[model samples]
Target: MSTEERLIESARALLWERGYTGTSPKAIQQRAGAGQGSMYHHFSGKPDLALAAIRRTAEEMRAEAEEQFSAPGTAVDRIGAYLRRERDVLRGCPIGRLTQDPDVMADPVLRAPVDETLAWLRGRLAEVLEEGCERGELVGAPDPRAVAATIVATLQGGYVLARAADSVQPFEQAVAGLLDFLAARVPTDHE
Candidate 1:
């Protein structure tokens, strides 16, 4: 990879491990196997490099979500597919983890990608919920936005639970429980 590419990938890895507050330009430089001058040539500083890495992570996650959302099936099926998508349960949500880092949350420019990415995802899930209602698959007056928020929270919290327990079972159980509820609550017409 090019020096810039290497730097960004290294940033992603480091950010995932150490978060915004814990990572530094020098550390990133060392991890990338690039010199300080080279890193500076490509990025203004640590924050700038972090912005690129965060944006990349958001895009990657959004793409995966879209893949599941686009599949042929009811909203529940699509969402279930997404909930069950392969994940490193113990690693937690990369973007969500940033929210815990003071530095990341403090920087407006740095937080934009993370905020927008999550907002877009919640909106997309809400759209799916609305579609399900329209198709009569879900028979309830549920607020799509609220349901979407709950769904995302469940997944995000699932990761946290898994990481805390040092096991994937909690994550799997959380998703399974959420999916089961969503499936069981299938709206009935004229109820």
Candidate 2:
């Protein structure tokens, strides 16, 4: 990869593994096998490079979600697919992790992509739920927007629970509980 690409990728990985405060420009340079000159030449500074990395990670997250959202299935099925998709559960979410970093959250430029990505996920999920309700699949379902928010919360919370316990069971149980809640809302005739 080019020096620029390497730098961005290294930053992305470091930012996920360590928080913004913990990932220094020197560490990123070392990981990328690029020198100080290369890093500065390609980007203005750490924040600039971090913005690029965060944006790339956010974009990847959206694309992955879209894959499940657009799949041929009912809304619940699609959502379940997303929840159960293979992930580095122990490592936690790349974008979600950024939310915990004070440095990232404090910087509007660094935080914008994180905020936008989450908002987009919630909105997209709400759209799917609304579609299901309109189709008579999700009978008597709660408000789509609220439910979408709940789903996002549950998923993020699940990550926290799993990480705290150092086990994936909590995450699995959390997801299963959510799936059950959603399934209960489905019309009996459709089940």
Candidate 3:
């Protein structure tokens, strides 16, 4: 990869591993195998590079979610696929973890992508739930927006629970519980 690409990627990894407050430009340069000159030549400073990394991570996350959302299946099926998709559960979410970083949350510029990505996920899920209701697949379902928020909370909270226990079972159980809830709402005629 080019020096710029290396720098951005290194920053991404470091930011996920270490929060904005912990990731130093020197550490990013060292991780990228780029010198100080190379880093500065390619970007203004740490914040600029970090923004690029954060945006890339957010974009990738959206694309991955869209894959499930656009797949040929019922809304619940699609959502189930997303929730069950393989992930590095112990490592926690790249974007969600950033929300815990005081520095990231304190800066509007740094927080924009994280906030936007989550809102987008919630909105997209709500749209899927609404579609299911319109199609008569999700019988007697709650409000789509509320359900969407619950789903997001469950997933994010699942990550925290998994990390806290140093096990993936909590995350798996949370997802399973959510799936069971949604399954119960599926109309028997549709099933």
Candidate 4:
């Protein structure tokens, strides 16, 4: 790959593996196998390269989530599929991990993509729930926006809990609990 591409990819991996403060430009260069001059030529600085990486990561995440969100199923089923989707649970979320970094959270430029991506996720979830409610598949369902926020919060929190325990069971249990709650809202005729 080109030096610029390599730099961005390296930055993304480093940023995810180690938070913003931990990911130094020298480390990124070493990982990418690029020279200092090459990195400077491609990016203004570490933050610039990190922004590119963050944007790329966000786009990738949205695409992955869209696969299940757009799939054919009742909204509840689609959500179940999303919640149950395979993940490297011990590693935690790439974007969500940024929320724990003081530097990333303090810098608006670095934080924009993370903030926008999460807002989009919540909005997309709400849209699906609203669709199911309108179709009578989710009869008497609670407010879609609130439910969407809760789902995102739960997933993120699950990651934290799983990491703290050094196991994936907490994440799985969290998903199971959410699925159970959602199933209860499904109309009897639809079940």
Candidate 5:
């Protein structure tokens, strides 16, 4: 990879592992195997480099979600597929982890990609839910926006629960519980 690409990749990994406050320019340089001159030549500074990394991470997250969202299924089933997709449960979400960083949250530049990516996810999920209602796959006119938010919360919260327990079971259980709740929300013919 080019020096810039290497720096961004290194930044993404370091930021995910250490958060903004803990990731230093020197450390990023060392990890990228690039010198200070190369880094500065490519980026204005550490924050610039970090922003690139965050944007890359956000793009990757959106692409992954879109893949699942685009799959053929009822909205609920598509959502379940997304929740059940393989992930490094113990490592938690790269973008979600940034929400815990005080520096990232406090800096608007740092937070924009994170905020926009999550908003896009919620909006996309809501769209799917609306489509399901339109197609009669969902018998009830549930609030799509609320359901979308809840789904995101469940996933993010599951990561926290699993990380706290130092096990993936909590995450799996959380996802399973969410899937059950979603399935129950679907109206049967008897209803």
Candidate 6:
């Protein structure tokens, strides 16, 4: 791979592991096997490199989620398919992981990708919820926005809980609980 592409790919992995605050330019360069000058040539600084990495990861995430969204099934089935997809739960969502980083959250340019990705994801989820309600798969208040936010929050929080406990169990349990709650909201044929 080209030095610039390698640098970005290496940076993406490190950023996901150490976050923007914890990852250093030197570490990224070494991981990419690129010289300091090579890195600087490709990126103005750590923030610039990180921004590129975040943007790429965000795009990848959105595409993956979209796969589940467009797949054949009820909205609940599709959402459940998404929630149950294989994940490095302990490492967390690369996009979601950025939300916990003070440095990334502080800069508009650096933070925009993270914010936009999550916002779009929540909107996607909300769209699915709205569709399910329209199709009579779900019932009640029909607050798709709030439900979407909750789903995202639950996932982000699940990662936190799982990481703290050093196991994917909490993450799995959280999804289970959410699926159960959503299932309970499924309407009876008469209702």
Q: Could you give candidate 6's per-residue lDDT for residues 72-143 as a string of tens digits? A: 888789999999999999888889888889999999999899989999999999999999888888888348
| Model 1: per-residue Cα lDDT over 1-191, one tens digit each | 99999999999988999998788888888988999999999999888999999999999999999999999998889999999999877888989888888888889999999999989989999999899888888865469899899889988898898899999999899898888878766865423
lDDT of 1 at 82: 93
- Residue pairs with colliding backbones in model 6 are none
Inter-residue clash pairs, candidate 4: none
Error of 3 at 86 (Å): 0.7
Model 3 misses residue 118 by how many Å? 0.1
Q: Write the per-residue lDDT of candidate 3 for residues 72-178, one digit (tens) a residue.
A: 99999999999999999999999999999999999999999999999999999999999998988898889999999999999999999999999999999999999
- Segments in model 1 whose C-alpha atoms lie over 4 Å from true places: 187-191
lDDT of 5 by residue, 45-146 (tens): 999999999999999999999998999988888988899999999899999999999999999999999999999999999999898788777765559999
Q: How would you order the candidates by lDDT, starting with the best?
A: 3, 2, 4, 5, 6, 1
Whole-model Cα lDDT of every candidate shown, in order: 0.89, 0.95, 0.96, 0.94, 0.92, 0.91
- What RMSD does each model have against the real structure? 2.1, 0.7, 0.6, 0.7, 1.7, 1.7
Which residue pairs clash in candidate 3? none
Residue-wise C-alpha lDDT for candidate 4, range 1-191, written one tens digit per residue: 88899999999999989999999999999999999999999899999999999999999999999999999999998998999998988899999999999999999999999999999999999999999999888877779999999999999999999999999999999999999889989978786
lDDT of 6: 0.91
TM-score of 5: 0.96
Q: What is the lDDT for 36 in model 3? A: 99
